[model samples]
Target: MSLRDMNCTFSPAALDAPDVASLLAELDGWAISGARLERRFALRDYHETIAFVNALAWMTHQQDHHPDLLVTYNSCTVSYCTHSAGGSLTNNDFICAAKADALYAQRAGA
Candidate 1:
């Protein structure tokens, strides 16, 4: 789906609200965690994972919104919470999440 389509799924104000556990469950298999748009992603190898993180960093910089990122030897985890909203989720979070997912898909295809 396009970014616009994804954007239509959430609103800036709505994202800051509490999360819905059931909605999050839908993305469980994609390695995303948490509710209300707070999610995590895990990669298989250090090289690939780091590359993905770098891409995410670049995207975050462009968006001017950041996520909590943790990197390990062969895995990376990302937590999305709008700091401006007091550690909650925002539309920006999901926008970044979708972009990251696209990046991950591109890497996997490569």
Candidate 2:
């Protein structure tokens, strides 16, 4: 199944570099920053940015996996890392990343 279809669970195991790389291939625009999976979405304006944030928030809230959000006038950078998995990248991070991509794509008409 695609990561977007996967839900966050009690994952105590962290992913290694090789595994992270392979999973990254399944996602778009996300990259490893330290121990987190991050991606920045550029929107049209502040209104659009906040609207996107709200939409993303709703989706992530359903998954029960929240990401660190850095929002500006036209962009929002989302970073995800599972603290339950030793503060490193986990399958939860990748799953959320894929969902983020889908959300952004819908907003961007891609």
TM-score per model over all chains: 0.68, 0.93
Which digits, one per residue and each the tens of the lDDT, describe model 1 over residues 1-110? 54423642323554423353333443433333554344456677788888888988887787777778778877666777666666555566666666767776787646
Q: Which candidate tops TM-score?
A: 2
Q: Which stretches of candidate 2 lie over 4 Å from their true place?
A: 108-110
Clashes of each: 1, 0
CA RMSD of each candidate after superposition: 4.2, 1.4
lDDT for each of the candidates?
Answer: 0.62, 0.89
